[model samples]
Target: MTTPTAKRWEIVDLIANRTVTAGEYKPSIKDYLSELTVKPLTGIPVALAVLYAFWSIFSSFAGALVTDGFMVKLFDNYWLPWIQNVWPNPDSVLYFLFVGDPLADNCFEAFGMLTSGLFVSIGVVLPAIFIFYLMMTILEDSGYLPRLAVLMDGLFHKIGLHGYAIVPAILGLGCNVPAVTATRNLETKKQRFIMMVLLAVFIPCGAQLGIMLDVIPETVGWVMLYLIIGFCLFGFILGKLIPGGNPEILIDIPPYRRPALQNICKKLWVKTKGFFINAIPFVLLGILFVNVLYLLGVIQALADLFAPLFVTWFGVPKETVGPLIAAFLRKDLAVAQLSTIAMTPYQMITAVVLISIYFPCVATFVVMLKEGVKELAAAVGVLAVIVFLYGGLIHLIGILLGVA
Candidate 1:
């Protein structure tokens, strides 16, 4: 009969079967995995709840700072001077009205969205996302994210999706491009498609939502709430419609701990850098594109091309054409430009919602191409068309219901 010590040695030897480690420090896979379980899970949803509250408060303060202070000055002092340097007629109403239009100003300062709206829009939005990501990363590293997946599984399963889709939902709050790109983590094609299209359609990014609240007032809050409800309902319906295999989840959950400061900064740098590098150029280029389009009268061409739909079908002003085109580049910027226009609360609500899911930003677009599902590209086009159509529909429906 083997002694107790011999039994321990045998277990060690069995664990070390794959290695040649003198059979001393080896252990079974069960033992190794058990080491991970020793740390108690204070749970995931609680951490997420904490994080949501943090972002909401901080983001509003940042948006207010930029809108009232930095934004006001950048336009008044710097942008005005730069425009004057080019047009020599900086004080003109047209110059003030369409701050980025190149007519009475050099194209440099005429980029209204990048200059005027950037601070309040991006400065506020990015920080909020950063705080959110920071909390998410801590939760993730601490093993809360996996447990979160488990906790959410029952509800998510009813929607025909695995709970892992929560990762993209978090990302979608930051931006859809990264969220779509993240679908790579999902095992099946169907999970990826449902997550991608649903995320693209329903989720409003941190920046757009922040600015919408800042610019539109209390009623926009109602629109925002309605849109969120719309997202959940549609997301559930799409998940049911999409067919997919659910892979069994097996994740290593680490004990919760302080995320290293270096890691948070690195994450912040990578994400924010990626965001701006994609954003700034597109914003400038969109303004440039508009400048050229206006120069060549292509905008007029498109407006004339679709005049009936612009005036009759959508119930928005014809001038909204420029902002709509600009949205393909950056939705927040396009929405900012829309603030300069005179429209009713209903029109504003409809326009904002339309642009909310209008399309992924340029950075996100590249991610879509890279993720490379044949259906997703088509989904992008479909979502864009739906954004406008749905926006109009929502407005019409709300009016009929007396909510509008």
Candidate 2:
């Protein structure tokens, strides 16, 4: 063999024979699912079905089963009555601050730090977020989220973002605080800013969603329609106006695998822990702050002053001012408060939408500030304009539809 010089082709074939080993390949079900989820033809309907299931489970388990069937009865029938009787001195400032209205029948009407705060945080929001995080974790660990991102990439690009933007958008539905941080995954400053603003304005947190299902279940669909419209409309405008590069990104889609129970439990625990530490305090403090403002006559004064703007422009009542103020601290609490106010169904819809879009909760605002004070300032400015324009636009739509 050494005596005979080998041709280059023969040497190349010898190397290939040693290196490459061909085998029969059979596609697995996981492979078929992966393809079905990423392609446009099949993926869109699958995405719709998945989201519908998500919403259905979130509403039924969190809203109906846990909160309505259990928490409502527990808090309203037993807890509220017991607290009302035992809290001592219903007339005292401390009593009012902690227990709210002396004769109120339910936790939602109580408005006290200890009464409504605990109820809203534990009874309503906790279940909602738990279910949301559970489903979200399942979607994430099963390797479906990346495929969702890929499917959404084309639509998102029209708004100056890649497919990955859906991650933050979905996160925002649970809570905007984490969603603001999630924007770091975006490639450019403009994308982050747009995402932050959109999240702050358009996406209602799980707490709000839970309460909405409880309070305005019939009209929640309309409210959501308006929000989705605003999200895309402003996103497109920002994509055109903002000065930054929207670059393409490479997404690494992992093979489908069974989500490990240990991993899901770990993620769920971490998320629940975050909500307890970051959100519960705010819910309690929000009630306290609003109560103090009420006692100080600030809420009444502001309501009187804003009566013209709120009534004339937003097509909502001046009383919405109080809830709007509370909204700064917690939008869910504000929505709950809004339910107590007297308004036409249309006005109620507008007021709730206003509360949803007006400003990010203090927690979200703080996180945005941490991202960059300058960015925060700019976001606030954009928010102000969006509130004015979009609020008026909704009112205008209502007027055209004869609903305002």
Candidate 2 clash pair list: none
Q: Candidate 1: deviation at residue 390, Å?
A: 2.8
- Pick the lDDT winner: 2
Please report the candidate that would top TM-score against the real structure.
Answer: 2
RMSD, one per candidate, in order: 6.7, 3.5
- Sequence-dependent TM-score of model 2: 0.95
TM-score for each model: 0.76, 0.95
* lDDT on C-alpha atoms for all candidate structures: 0.65, 0.94
* Cα-lDDT of candidate 2: 0.94
> Candidate 2 on 324-369: residue-level lDDT in tens?
9999999999999999998888888899899999999999999999
266-334 per-residue lDDT for model 1 (tens digits): 887887787677665665566656656776788788877767775666666677777778777777667
